[model samples]
Structure formats: structure tokens, C-alpha cells
Target: MREEYEIYEQSLPWILEAGEIIKKRIQEHTEIKRKSSHSDVVTEVDREIESFLVSKISEHFPEHNIVGEENVGNRVSSSPYLWIIDPIDGTSNFINRKKDFAISVAFCERDRGIFGIIYDVMAGKLYRAHTGSGAFLNDVELNAAGTDGSLENELMAINAPWGSMEEMKRWEHFFKLGTQVRGVRNYGATTMELSDLATGVLGGYVQYYVNSWDYAAGRVILEELGYKFSDLNGDAIDRVYCGGILAASESLHQQIVQSLKESSKEIK
Candidate 1:
């Protein structure tokens, strides 16, 4: 318990400090590089912030394994204590000068995530959680008691690919959910969307493909707030690869999962 709390205590400060670094670079000109296509990109600032975080973590916890989006070195470690990081989650949004970008950091032991932190750099809101400890938005605790129910009356966030015709081949089931909900949102940033879901600002989130660093931290925080998580096929989140993700209340999660299953059969 003491060790867990120590990890939790130091994470917030490091994340907040990273946020400050991100915010300071918002106006300065930075080179952007296309990773695969024009839509998928990275920035010099992303690499810089990631390097800064890796340095800090190595200095403070050399024994811990580090996996970051920008720099993963040559080999991947399967250490029991691992740190997964997305230095700048919404690089496209950041380069486009949107405020929805965020920093996500998660500490996990094997498959169990111990603590997670997501900081909205522009909004100055910090979302954090530790195993068995409730999630918090800054100093305020987020729990089922504090959440607004009325599942049908709530809004949800779906990945952007679900919004189009050509891209909706596999995610058409997800698009159908958007029609039934009160409303739907697409922030193009996983951590930012998940932060809103944990706070009840958004009711749920569904993403067809997301990496460990993309949703790792937000997963811990959301599940702690009584949100359920699974793949579209209703499997546990795969911590290593790009896994389809769904998060919401139990009823909402079931509703979406069942619909996806039924949809697949209908198509066949």
C-alpha cells in the first residue's frame, strides 16, 4: 500500500509538469512529421516531452520498464512494474491548436494497472486514480454516487472513423449506437474523451482501435469510476496491441456489446 501510494503521489506532479511543458510549446513553431499518412502524425514537441518524461522516470525508478509512443528504445520490456505513456495524446489536435489534447501516464504491474493519470493541458484539469482508491478530477472524487445516471439521456464519444461512410465498414455497429443515444461526440483524442467519461461529462466511449499508451491510463481511471471496459467483441482489453475499446455503465456497455454481436450475425 505504501509503495502504491508513493507511485500515485509522484505521478500527478510529473504529469502536471509535462502539461506545463506542453502548454509552453503550444505557440512556438515545431516541425510535424507524417508517420503513415497525412492524417497520422507526430511533432518535435511530442518527442521532446516524451524524452523528458523517460529521463525523469529512469532517474527516479530505474528498475521500472518504460514504454512510450515516441521512444521505446530498441526492445520492449515485460517487467512486472511498467510505465506506459502517451506524451501528447492528440498530436493532430495539438498541431491544429485545439484544446482537447492531453498527457496520459499509467503504471501497471504485469496486466493489472496500479495507477493512472491524465492531464488536460489547456483545461488545467487533472484526472487520476489508483487501484481500490476512487478516481478524482483534480481534488474532487468521482464515483457512482456523484455520477449522473439516466443512461439513455447521456451523451457518448465514438472514434472518428465511425463518423464516415467508407470507414464505417467494421464500425457501422458503433455508428448505429450514435443514432440511439441522446447525442454523440468525437474529440479525436482518447485520453481527453475518457477523462470526460470518468467525470460524467460524457456518458460513454467506443473506439475501434487504440494502443496501450492511448488508453492505458484512462482505462484505470474510468474502471475505478464504475465504468465497464471491453472490446467490441466483449473481450478484456489487450494491453499490448491495438484493441477495440468500449467503456460506460454496465447497462450501457451491455447494450452496445449486444448490439455489435447481433449486427455481426445479421451481416453474415
Candidate 2:
């Protein structure tokens, strides 16, 4: 218990420090480079912030392994502790709008989350959680309670994908959900979307694909609020991050999962 508290307490400052670095760095001109595709990108600031965090973690906890978006970390370690970080969750958003990006960090032991922190840099909102303890938006404790569990009354966020047969099929599932919900929104930033979800502003999230750094921290925080996670096909996520993701209340989650599976069969 003490160890969990220590992780959160220590990580809080590190994340805040990283946020400050982001604020200063964004003011200066930042160079962007595309990876895999034009839509997927990285920034010099992304590498800088990640390098900054990696240095801190290495200095403080030399035994922990790190997996970061920028790949600037001491990944080889004998200890079971691991750190996952997305120095900037929305590189494109950060590049274009400069306001929607976030810094996400998570610490885990044996693939189980010890704590997670997501800092909405522009909003100055810090969302964090630890296992067994409820999530929090800064000092305000957050819980998943009193939800109607009705898809019609809830707003959802989706990562829209268009291309290929499988991608289009996933898009169809997203469209189906969009029609049922009160509204659909996209932040282009997973951490921000998740912060809102934890606070009940958004009911669920569906992304056809995401990487470990993209959703790891938010996953830990959301799991604390009774949110259930799974692949689009209804299989348990089990900390898997290289595939589709769905997050919602248990009933709503299963509802979407079943609906998507049924839709897939009929559409093909």
C-alpha cells in the first residue's frame, strides 16, 4: 500500500515537471517528422520530454524497465517494474492546435498497474489513480457511479479509421455506435478522451487500434472507476495494447461488443 502511494506521489511531480517542459518547448518552433504515415508523427519536443522523463526514472529507479513512445529509455531491466510513457499523446494535435495534447505515464509491476497519471497540459487537469483506490481529477475523487448505462443517453468518443476492408468494417461498427449515442466526439488524443470518460463527461471510447503508450496510463486510471475494457471483438484486453480497444461501463461495454460482433457478421 505504501509502495503504491509512493509511486503516485513521486510520479505526480515528475508529470508536472514534464508538463512545464512541454509548455516552454511548445512556445519555441518544433520540428515534426512523420513515421509509418503522415498521420502518425513525432516531434523534437516529444523526444526531449521523453528523454527528460527517462533520465529521471533511470536516476531514481535504475531497476525498472521503461517503454516510451519516443523510445528513449532504459528498457532492459531485471526487475518486474515497468514504466510506460507517452511524452505527448497527441503529436498532431500538439503540432497543429498546441492545446489538445497530453503527457501520460504509468507504472506497473508484473503487468499490473500500480498507478497512472495523465496530464492535460493546456487544461492543467491531472487525472490519476492507483489500484483499489478510486480515480481522481486532481484532488477531487472520481468514481463510476449513477450511470444510466443507456447507450442512447451517453456520448461516446471514437477513433475513426477509413481504408481497407477490415478498417472499413471497424468504421461501420463505430458508425453504428455513433447512431445510438447522444453524440460522438473525437479528441484526437487518447489521454484527454479518457480524462473526460473518468469524469463521466464521456460514456465510452472505441479505437480500432492503439499502441501501448497511447492508452496505457489512461487504462490504469479508468480501470479504477469501474470501467471495463476489451478488444472490439469482446476479448479481454489483458494489458494488450497493439490492437482495438473499447472502454465503457460493464453493461454498455458488453452491449457494444455484442452489437459490433452481430453487425460484423451481417455486413460481410
Give the alpha-carbon lDDT of every model. Answer: 0.81, 0.85
Candidate 2: Cα lDDT at 52: 90
Candidate 1 lDDT score at position 19: 82
1-268 in candidate 2: lDDT tens per residue?
Answer: 7976886788789889999989988879988888999888998999999999998888888888898988887486789888998999989889889899899998888769888899999889999988888888889999774445888888889777867987676478678778888999998998888888888899889988888888888889988888887888878765536888998888888878887887677777
Candidate 1, run of 10 with poorest lDDT: 143-152
The residue-by-residue lDDT of candidate 1 on 157-234, one tens digit each, is 877463466666766677677777789888889998898888778888888788889999998898777778888777
Question: TM-score of every model?
Answer: 0.92, 0.95
Measured by C-alpha RMSD in angstroms, how accurate is candidate 1? 2.2
Most TM-score-accurate candidate: 2
Best by lDDT: 2
Model 1: lDDT of residue 264: 69
Clash pairs for candidate 2: none
